[model samples]
Structure formats: C-alpha cells, structure tokens
Target chain A: MNRIVIGRYIPGNSFLYRMDPRTKLIAMILLMVSVFLIQSFIHMLVALLLVALLLVFGGISVKRVYLGLRPLVFLLIFTFLFQVLFNRQGDLLYSLELHYTVLNLSIAMALVIMWGFTKRFLRFRLLYFLATVAGVFLLFHYLPFGIVLGEGTFSVYEQGLSTAFFIMVRLVIIITLSTILTITTKPTDLNLGLESILRPLRILRINAEEIAMIIAISLRYIPTLLDEANKIMLAQASRGVDFQEGKLKDKVIQVVSLLVPMFIISFQRSDDLANAMETRSFVPGQKRTRLHILHWSGLDTTALAFTCAALIGVILLRVVGW
Target chain B: MNMIDIENLSFTYGGKVEALKNVSLCVKKGEWVTILGHNGSGKSTLAKLIVGLLKPQKGTIRVDGVELSERTVHDIRKKVGIVFQNPDNQFVGVTVRDDIAFGLENLRIPREEMIERIEHYAKRVDMYSYLNKEPQALSGGQKQRVAIAGILAMRTEVIIFDEATSMLDPDGRKRILSYMRKLRDDGVTVVTITHDMREAVQSDRIVVLKDGEILKADKSEDVLKDKETLEKSNLELLLPLEVLHGLEHKKSTNEEIKEFLWQLSLNG
Candidate 1:
C-alpha cells in the first residue's frame, strides 16, 4: 500500500518545481494531447526523447518514472498482448502450430488437466497468459482433433506489433508526464492551480471552488485513508483474518471483513471532519483566501509558451503530412 | 472569568442513548481541567458540546462570555478549539504546515500572518522542522502535536483535547502531556478529556463522569483522595496512588505512606 505513490508530491526545488502550477498544469494537458497525436514510430521515439529531457531537466530520475508505471505493468502488458494477438493487418511475422486431443480424453481426465492448468496459471499468471495465447494459436494451426474453424493458420502481423508498441509507448508517456506533474507540485498548489484554471467555468454555472476543495480534500485524505486501511488490515490479521493464506472463499470473507470496517471508519471520519470543518468556520462557497498565492514568473511563461509551441508544432506536422 | 460555562447540558443519540445528561461545568480562564471517564462515559460528548460540534437537547454553553447557539456558535468557536481523538482523522491538511494553516485559513487570516502563526505555533509544539512532512509520515504523537499547533494557530482562548493521547504510546503520550502542560502555563484554558489517571492527576481540576453524568468534580489532589468516586467512574489509580490509598485506608500518616511506597518500590 505504501508503494502506491500516485498523486503524491515530493518536495523539490527543481525548475519544474519553481514553475507556476497553472503553467505546469496547462503544459501537462498539452503534453498529454501531443502524446496521443504521435502517429509514427519515429514520433513515438521523439516523444520519448522529449519526456526523458523533461525528466532530466526537472531533476527527476528515469527509475522514478518507471516506479510510477510499476502499478500499471500488468494492464500495459495485457493491452499489448490483446492488441498484438487480435490485430491482423500488415505482413505476417510468424506462425505457431498446436496439437491437443480433447475428444480422446475422459471427463475425469479433462477435469484433472484443467485443475493442474488452473494451479499453474494462478502461480505464474503472466507466463501462463503468454502460454495460453501461444496454445490458442498452435491449436488453430496444427490441431484437427474435434473441429476445424477456418484456414487453421495462426500468424502475427507487423501492424499488430507496431500498433501494440505505439499504444504501450503512449500509455507510458501519459502516465510518466502525469507522475512528473504530481510529484513536482504540492497538493495545495495543485488545488489552487486547478481552481484558477477552472475559474472561467463559473460562467457555466459550475462551482469551481467547491470542486477544487473536493479534489484537494480527497488528495489530502488518500494517504491518510490508506494508512487507516493498513491499520485495519493489520487488526483483522491479528484477529486471524488469514488474508495471505486463505482459500478463494476465505479470501472473499477476509476482504469483506477489511472493507466493512474501513467503510464504517471512513463514514465516522467524514462525520468528524464535517464537524471539525464547521467549527473552523469553513462554509462551503464562501470566499476564502489562501496562504500560498501562485505567482507566474518568467520561467512559468517560458514553460507555458514552450508547451504551446510544441503542441502547435505537432499539429502542424500532422497537418502538413510530415 | 469563566472561559467555558455549561448549564444543564443534555444530549441524546437517536432519542435513545443519552450521551450527556444535565452536565453542567464551569472552567475558569487558564485552568487546566481534565475530564476522566471510562469507555462510553459522557466526557467525549461534553467535549463536543463545548466545541459546539453537538447541540444539547436542553442546555446552554457559553464560551468567553459568548452564548453558544446556531447564530452564535461560529463566534464561540473563535474562542474555543478542539483536538479530537484519532489523530489521523482530525488532521485536515496534507502537510504539517498546511494543517496548521487550515484553521487560520478558515478564519481568513492574511497570508503573511498565517505564515507567522504557523511558524510560531509549529515551533511551540516542536514540529517546526516537520512542517513540510505529510501527516501520515509522522508518528501518532507528532500528529497530535500538529493538531494542537493547528488549534493554537487560531489563537483560541480555550482548547479542548478529546482523548488526544489515547491513541499514542507511552512516550508519545508523555510528550503530548508535556505540550499540554506548556499550553496551560501559557495561559490557555486547557480541557483534556481522558481516562488516564496519571494525566488527570496533572490537571488543576479533575471531573469524573459515569453513565452520562458527573460523578465527581474537584481539585486534582482532592479528587485523587476520593477512592469511591474513582471506583464509580471505573478509573484505575496509578500503582503508587493505589498503594497510598491502601495505606491511607489503614489510617497511616502521609510520611508513613510515602515511606512504605518508597520501600515497596525499592524492594520490587
């Protein structure tokens, strides 16, 4: 739980840290849009280079960026695999052949095989997933035991591989840039920055201040709630919840045990917080001042201008068939 | 002048459970009053009542000469602050500095003065260096200290601590109690709601609550002598206090009781 570092701010005095939050926020949006605009492999590589440069100039390490992407490793790999396997455009790269005789096996034997496969899959999920994909292709290419579907050929496409690679790169760039923004900016500054940027939405009958306050409060409580949930987990463990060593049914029970108490504790906490805020004279929609007033310095303007130029350049490149 | 005055305060939860019943108490300015009670006793309820967190069904609370009502509660809150139990839940800011600034921001203090008060109170609580640290990164005691600093930054005349040290370890609790003592010395009316007899003994006055009613209210020394009241409140006496009480029951002199406790400590 402690390893989950999303939306956490690390204090630093780097160039990114010194930039106004509004500048960074706007720059983040532009960078995010530009990442999706990446069309060719060369554009993806250039985007990666720009991201690395930003990380270096911002005094953030590559390992830190990798750490930010660590939690999404499984999802990224899953998406990559789905895109690679299902996509059938472009030249064939390789083919696989598989053989299995399900018709010859008895029902009991089939159940045993399925049980063994399940055990192995649970133990080594990622490896088992790759194996399953390979097994499917091999079965289509070689096996003719029960029924035949089509040409019975399983082939990989260059377009599939490239598309998968592009998507993975896009996801990594977006996540890493977001991580950089959050890591460099303080929560209060982020709140104020978002509030000021969204201040124009007041004309649309939106409560930007309240929305900002909600976001700020949620950010503030994320780590705190995580800590409380950790404590509750430990307490339940001490009471023999057996979370780590449990059957599927037992695990469900243990999870419910943890969640129920967490929900109760959080509700009680919100009540206390409401009272505390009220006692502190925090009225919703009231004009409130902040201790840290954001000042847009020369660095902020330059950063914003650079992001806008980069965004326009990307759009221009795409429009002019570069 | 009385900093907090409660008259016939009664509160019920869901019209069934009486949390506080006809609880009336007066705390003078600069007085360090500790409310002692066991679990489910009405002390926490009273603390909430004083801070205007909960409205009494039939009573009145006056803080610093301002009556506490729906209209006047905000004004009363300006003079009365509370640091509740569960240090994690009470902290409203992501960082220590921001937490201290929370109350100040609510009061609309200017940024310059907010900075000054955040620094001053954080230093007073010895949490100046940790101003940038997240609340979750700090120990329970450190968080409680930050909570106190947050309240102090508001410059409230009376600060009520609702079991603030109940969640802390011995060392942490001792550190917080020392801070509370410092706050008392600085002329802040400190109301501590706790069941720890040791903490109660350090206060200027101890009010024992039992079954949603006041069991005993007296000076710390006088209250410590009332074994019946302590027993009724289910508040355990310290080992030394227990020994002293045992010796006093046998009609021993103060010197003899002290000598006996001393010898017992040495022998043990």
Candidate 2:
C-alpha cells in the first residue's frame, strides 16, 4: 500500500538486477532503436520471440511483467484502433458504410505489431543481437517492401509501421529499462551512483551535492507521501466523494481535492526535512559517514560486459544493414 | 559546568504573538530537568532556543559556557539534539537506521564508524530489531524510541524532549520515561518539556512556565510541593509529592488529603 506507482523498485538478485545501472541505461537506449527499426511482420514476430526468451533468462516472472503492462492496456488498444481507422490506401477489408475507413493491413498489422513489440521484452532480458535483427525484419514486413500505392506511391502501411512501431518501441524501451534499474538498485545506492556519476559536473560549478541531496530527500519521502495520498483518498471516499462514481467533471473535482491535500502534505514534509537536515549539520561540504556500503562485484562487471556487448551488437547490426 | 544557561530570553512570532517572555533558567551538566508548561506556555520554544532552532529576541543563551549566536548555532546544535513532539515530522531518514545515519552523514564521520555508532545507539534505545523499518509503520512509542536512537546515535551531550512522550499511549509513555531515567543515570543532560507532573516530580529539577514566563524553577521536591505557585500557573501540583510533604508536616485538614498524607507517613 505504501509503494509508489513510479520509481517503485522490487529488490531481487537476478543477473539483470546485478548489472551496472549505467550499462543498463545505455543498453536500453540501443534496444529501443532496434525494436522500432525493424519493419516486416516476420521481423516483429521474431523480435517478440527473442524478447520472450530473454524474459525467461532474466528470471522475472511473466505474471509480474504482465501486471506491469496492465495499466497501459487501454493505451495499446487505443493505438491499435487509431492505426486501423486512420490508415487509408490498403485494401478496404471491412467498412460499416458510416464514416469509418478500416484497412485490411492496418487491423492485422496493428495486432501483430503490438504483439511483436510486447512479447519477451516486457519481462526484460539481454537479447541485443537477435532483437535488432528481428526489429529490422518487422520494419520491412509491413512497409511497402516491393509494392507502391499505384501512383503517388504513399503506403499507409509503411508510414504507420515506421511511425507507430518507433513510438511504441521508444516508450517500451524506456519503461522496461527504468523498471529494471529501479527494481534492482537500492535507493541509497542509486543516490550514491548519481553523486559519483555527476561528480564531473563540479567543473561546471553545478553543486552536485545539492542536486544529489534533493534527489535523496525526495526518494526518502516516497513512503510518507504515499501514506498521505492514501489517507486523503480514504477520507474522501468515506465522505462519498466518489471519483469513479461521477461524471468526468465530478471525477476531476475529486482528483483536485486529493491533489490539494497531497501538495500540502508534500510541502509540510519538505519543511520538516529542511529543518531536520539543517539541525543535523547538513552544511555544504560537510563530512559525513554512510551506514550502507554498495559493493561492485564480479556480477556487476559481467552484467556490464553483457549490456555493452548487446548495445554494440545492435549498432553493428544497424551499421551492416542487417 | 552549566549545560545550558538562559537569561531574559524572549521570542515572538511575526512580531505579534509572543511565545516566550523573560524566561531565565540554568541546567547544570548531567542534570535531568523537566519544564512543565501547558499548551502555549513557551516550553517548546525554550527547547528550540537551546538547540539553536529559534533565535532569542531579548536574551542570552549560553551552551557549555559558549554564548549562542548565529555564528555559534551549529556548535550548539552539535551539543544539543532535540526530539520534537511529532516523531514522524522530526525524522529525516526513511528507515530507523538511515535516519540515525542522517545526522552522522551531516557530521561527515567515516562510513565504518557510522555503522558502529548507529548499531550502538539503536541497541541502547531497544530499537535494534527495527533498524530497517520505516518510521511511519512504527507505533508512537516505537517512533519515539527511534527518535531517541537517532539523537543518541549522534552522541550529543544534551538532549531535549519536546513533548516526545505526549503522542504515546500510557504504556508507551511509561516505557519512554523509564528509558529517560536510564539516560539520566548514564550522565546525559536531559531537558524534557512536558505537562506530566508525575514524571516531573522525579526529575532533578523542575521549571514551571505560565503565560510565556517562568513561574518557578527549583529542585523537583521543592517545586512539586509549591501548590499555590503551581495552581497560579494552572498546573496542578503532583498528588504523591504533596501528600508526602503534607504528611511530613501533618498539616492537611481535608479528610482525603489527610488520609493520603497519613498513608505516606506510614509507608515512609
């Protein structure tokens, strides 16, 4: 109940969890590009297959991965319907004769593309070499590979495939890697990493310590903030302030009420934190001790190596026009 | 050495509501002093002043013979740690251990030493098992314990409990008071701002506050026995202490008061 929807990390000791956060971050960027770069259905299908295999290797349960995606199911459906209706120029498979343009390739392509993009990868694994090749295959599958739109040569399938797949791929890549990083790294270690990584910013006179302190304080208050939100939600619900029971406007009003209290709580917490920090000798450049030590082990090195390999392999695949 | 000395201390919030006026007192090193004041009697304000959280408008505060000023506030803070009324609000760390580590981090102690200090203090406060638990999930008593551990972990000589036990249930209050006595016996200078005279009567000294001014400051025995002075401050004198004193004098006229006095004499 205290867990936040964002930055919610579950601690585990799998191979994915042990990777260096920086490596994970970079690999995610590469994976996103590869996922969207493929065009044909065969490529997408293969990509999904690769993702599934990685999910098994990464040791994250499929049930948990699916649960994470549950919240975005509506968005996925909306995107599919959007592509099917707005996409024109493909053979008109089914039209109700009432201001709706539905194309054959759009419907089948949307489902296959969605499935191709979602499988295995949602669970998060290291499959850079195969995934990129599969992505290229998917990229060429629906995009007017050997055909033209008869004259002007505008293929809806090609445009939709490139645009939709790229957008979905980017979104999935960011979300999955972030989840992977958060679930693996303890928050205190994450702060330390941020501090060490941003150390070079000292040359810019950016006051890295101050920025790191803000992030650490914000992270520390996560549970307290969640508790405040839940308390407001329950209090409002008891008073018949039913957000789900009302029209859009009423729901918005209810949400506003909840947000107002949450904001107030956050301000109060921050004030308390500021006072606490100041009293505890939290002066800039003050020497301090840490109770927890994060050790970079052999596992971390191996994970980093794997992540870097995946990233370079994906880029090479792209370079070679695979 | 006097742990803390306050002379003619006065404070106002926004130049309107006066929180404290002409408050003067002294707490010797290792003395357990209780400041008994009801709501708005300026007890907490005094605690804040001693810990350098609030600036005195018209007085001098000296901690360990060093005058408290803006330049010396940090030094005063290192000597005195305050546990605020709301344990939840006063805590800066997510977990009990982390919260204790917060102060150490600010002090910039080495990592190895910080871990040793945290465990030591957490054990003293009997919160060793809860080192990793979040403060919010703890009961009021447990939260207070964590708060104490956090302060004690810093190894400050003087500690101020500003209604630290008020949020607790009866049992929790009892446990905290017991721990406080233990701390006192261990030679830590403790300044507890409380309205609980039962606990106050057991302290080394008691300072009564009324209407933002010091009503009385004396040894607990003398202060607790001064019924007229206490009643004037809207604070009831402690029954047991009064009974024992009355019995010593054999001066009570009321039958119940007489009986209580008589029982005290017999017990003695």
Instruction: Name the top lDDT candidate.
Output: 1
Evaluate model 1: give its lDDT.
Answer: 0.84
| DockQ by candidate, in order | 0.62, 0.50
- Most TM-score-accurate candidate: 1
Candidate 1 chain A, poorest ten consecutive residues by summed lDDT: A99-108
Q: Write the per-residue lDDT of candidate 2 for residues B1-268, one digit (tens) a residue.
A: 8989989999999999999998889999999999998888888888877877788889999999999999999988898888877767767776788888888888878888889988998998889999877766788788888878878878889988888888889998998898889989999999999998877866899999987998888999888888888888888756666556566675656886667767766755
Can you give the lDDT of residue A162 in candidate 1?
Answer: 94
Q: CA lDDT of B116 in candidate 1? A: 94
Docking class of 2: medium
Off by over 4 Å in 1: A89-151, A235-250, B251-268
Residue pairs with colliding backbones in model 1 are A97-A138, A98-A138
Give candidate 2's TM-score. Answer: 0.80
What's the lDDT for all of these models?
0.84, 0.73
Q: Which 10 successive residues of model 2 chain B have the least lDDT summed?
A: B237-246
